[model samples]
Target: MSDLLRLATAGDVDDGKSTLVGRLLYDTKSVLADQLDAVTADSALSTPDLALLVDGLRSEREQGITIDVAYRYFATPRRSFVLADTPGHVQYTRNTVTGASTAQLAILLVDARKGIRGQTRRHAAVLALLGVRHLVLAVNKIDLVGYDESTFTVMAKQFAAHAAGLGYPRDAVTAIPISALRGDNVVDRGGRTSWYTGPTLLEHLESVHTAPDPDQTPLRFPVQYVIRPRSAGCPDYRGYAGQVAAGVVRCGDEVAVLPSGLRTTVAGIDTPDGRLVEAPAGQSVTLLLEHDLDVSRGDMITAADAPPALTDEFDATLCWLGDRPLRRGTRLLVKHGTRTIPAIAQELLVRLDEQALSLCGQPGELVLNDIGLVRLRTAEHVPIDDYDTSRATGSFIVIDPADGSTLAAGLVGADLPIQ
Candidate 1:
């Protein structure tokens, strides 16, 4: 396994995303002594509110709200971390979506005094929708609540009830009562709490198993580049260059290239040095086919034994993130796997009211951060598995054509009906 795990920190404004991140880094000794002194000095100059060092934005620094994503890197002996500090404001929900798109785990901060607010509910619902497996509800600012165990228990239970209703596993979340300002229950267990003796926030991150399942479905290789030999020694060579997306491709495995249903046998797996015995997901290499085949970009190579659903029109759950509300006839760019194609939003469906966690009436235009189902017809047939089945290949982003900004993100083939 690679030594890095991607994690995103999210919450409403002033929920301690920056301070929690700062505390995690500081307690793990990831920050330097000189930097600590500088932060200390900065804290002294401020109005005793310079706790959020991860708020790198000057505007956020002045306004005391996280406006952009701040990334911090730290590690323990067992695991390494790349924490994406996403914005808490409702306007920046698109940024949060981008940050959490690749995250295996999310560290969602909540104010201990306030418990779960509307923003907290919204962020949690978003993370759950995005398929984030693990959730660490850092009940920050515990010092403000007198480090009360009853307060922590009540908050955890309240949030747990809602999260369980969302179909998240009972044990998927681990709540840690912490005070990012006082450095309690973050790295070292807070001294004031004898009632709580669980792992610290840093400890949980260092020990969680947050990797995707090994490609157990079908072998998929999206052909990115075609390599043709130019020498007399190797005259007849047709190779497809790209990383494997899922399953495993062996030297003699029968494979079918998508969008054409052309069958071919893998002759060899080629690397810069030489041939590889096999290739799996994340291995960037070239495939030499036993027979000459016409392959190019936007073409997917799948296992002959098992194939993905080849369809032109499909339903998907989308989170609209564009400033200009989505209207009918809005042609956009759809990126699936390594394929980019022209697509048009066919329907508005319904706008999800996140504050109430339910669907409202029909919406003509999908505003910012509205999660709903959308119908998109592509220019060509694309092979996509269910998002619940294959997240790597079933998810796509919709980009606006006029201004060239990403408008929404979607997950295909979900069984749960759009609410």
Candidate 2:
């Protein structure tokens, strides 16, 4: 409860995911009566259409389940939360990945009556690969299963086995028995599951901390825009504006500006409201240097001691999300932070084996939602770090210059040279 938490709910269809979220919002007083009334009518009684609690779209209301990722915000007296309620259908699996991408904690729901399912495994793999540190397995619909201790214990063990296969640390997984429909063990310790001793779903969520300072590996700030103050009061103001990709940056620190390889010292750091002595990852502050340099929007600002290498060749993992198959010689635009470069898919090394949890030697082409290791060649040099070290600088997205839709998310590889 000390800091804000970001979490996503994922599971198979009809697992009471929407209901659980609705329960959280309702018990926390985050939902209004008018909305509750509409849900009641939609359900034809007190047993409201719980899916409507999250699938706010009218079309989704007609269908009675989520089709796209639905975002909801709620706050308790102790902590604030941003919840991403992802769809359960297989076709909308991408929605789960999209939701889990930014989540620090993943709430994976299972039907107490049904136990664990394949969708659970798939979602768990994505969460693990994306570096989600905290995972909560919410076994919903416990009341339907008569609040049986065996039911919960069995499902928890089954889930733990599969999660272990995914390479998630054993201590990272926590399972809680819940009845989303009856509001049992959601925000409060409901009486139905009194035999089970564990914190409520909300309690676990409030305690999980997932603030990642990936920028701590090194100071790397990709300039999004160059601000030139031609205003009357500050006509001489020239600065670069962007979020720090990694590391802490302070005024007077020796810094390097790429790709011209110019060295300079930080004269000042300023935000729109005022000047600052330092800035770190997640801060969108502007930087003013001691000397005027030819830094532009695509340039990178990095720490002098350890900086990302400017390179045109690299190995990366690409999860293809487009309709077209990615093969060698395919041209795409790689966008890392604010830098975009024309890149070619040199090779598709191995197709991810989700079932075996191993990479295969050969695959024709990566299809939609397929994750694979890949080799790429860029037209211009872009400084980057491995995704594990600096998420801000290490990640990139491939785009089709033809239509501009996002195709794949990339992570820097060990093969890339460090400057």
Q: Give the top-scoring candidate (TM-score).
A: 2
TM-scores of the models, in the order given? 0.89, 0.91
lDDT score, residue 124, model 1?
A: 81
lDDT of 2 by residue, 162-198 (tens): 7787776788899999888777888889897778888
Q: Compute the lDDT of residue 140 as modeled in candidate 1.
A: 90
lDDT of every predicted structure (CA atoms) = 0.81, 0.83
Off by over 4 Å in 1: 1-5, 32-65, 207-214, 229-235, 415-419
Candidate 1 accuracy as lDDT: 0.81
Give candidate 2's error at residue 376 in angstroms: 1.6
